[model samples]
Target: MREAFHEQLDGVFDDLAGICRSVETAVRLATQALLSGDAAIAEQVISADADIDKAKEKIEDTCFQLLSLQQPVAGDLRVVVSALRMVTELERMGDLSVHVAKIARLRVPDIAVPEEVRPTLARMGEVAEDMVCRVEQIITTKDVEAAIELGRADEIMDGLRRQSFAELFADEWAHGVEAAVDIALLGRYYERIADHAVSVANRVVYVVTGDFPVDV
Candidate 1:
């Protein structure tokens, strides 16, 4: 019975990693579409978000089933509990990517990112993709230290967001308020995606060490 339970637990972890990969693809493509003004790619990202959502629901159901049937204790209990929290964070990351893609879709032939703020958004996208890849590693390996180090990546994302804001307020800024608003929101979407990655990593730490980090 214990062997079967462990197998189910492993399946849960595998599903989480799969969802993380989907989110990684979503953010990367969303950034590409945003920068290149490719409405088709943006639409693809938007449509695929539903699969991420469905995967989250399936994982949640599996976690709950494990809790009720297996009654996992101690370390095993922590793994199940942390998986619940981690899935939530991953779902939100997928949603944020969808939000970025929708912004791209709205602009259609014209790119949503303005010239002055393009570099900042571009960097943010790169950082977000890298962080999600690391997240997948942390999830699969259960490396507490790698999970904790993700906080530093979140800090870099925060800095990029600030840089974007500065660009909007610069004296040479020529884009109107609407463009300014889009850039601000885009920066936030990327930053929040990073934040959620950190959250997921912290949950992995909790699964391995039974304690979350002091800093969020």
Candidate 2:
């Protein structure tokens, strides 16, 4: 019975890692769609979001089953509870990617990001992608230190978000209010994605050490 329980737990982690990879792909493609004005790609990201939601639902049900049948305690309990929380953050990260894609779709045939701000937003996308990738590693390895470092990557995302806002508010801005709003919203979406990644990493720390890092 114990062996079977461990196998099920392993399966849960595998599914969570798979979901993270899917989200990473979604954000990367969403950025491409936003920059290249590819509404079709944006549509793909939007459609893929339903799968992310379904993945989260499936994992949550597994967790409930484990709690009810196995009655995990101590470190095992931490892992199960943390997974429940981590999946919530991962689902939100997926939603943020969908939000980015939706903006791309809304401005079909015309890029939502102005040329001057494209580089900043592009960097934001790269950071978000990298963070999610690291999140997968932390989840699988349960590296508490690596999880803490993920917080620093989130700081870079925050800086890039500020740069995006500065460009929007700059006096030289030629883009009208509508464009400005899109840029602002895009920056927030990317920043929130990074924030969710950090949240998941911190939860990983809690799973490993029984306490979340004070700083992460």
By lDDT, the best candidate is 1
What TM-score goes with each of the models? 0.97, 0.97
lDDT of each: 0.93, 0.92
- lDDT per residue for candidate 1 within 26-114, as digits (tens), equals 99999999999999999999999999999999999999999999998989988898899889999999999999999999998899988
Lowest summed lDDT across 10 adjacent residues in model 2 is found at 207-216
TM-score for predicted model 2 compared with the true structure: 0.97
Once model 1 is optimally superposed onto the true structure by TM-score, how far is the C-alpha of residue 59 displaced, in angstroms? 0.7
| Candidate 2 local lDDT, 64-157, one digit each (tens) | 9998999989888888888898898899999999999999999988999989999999999999999999999988898989999998998899
What does the lDDT come to for candidate 1?
0.93
Pairs in steric clash, model 1 = none
List pairs with backbone clashes in candidate 2: none
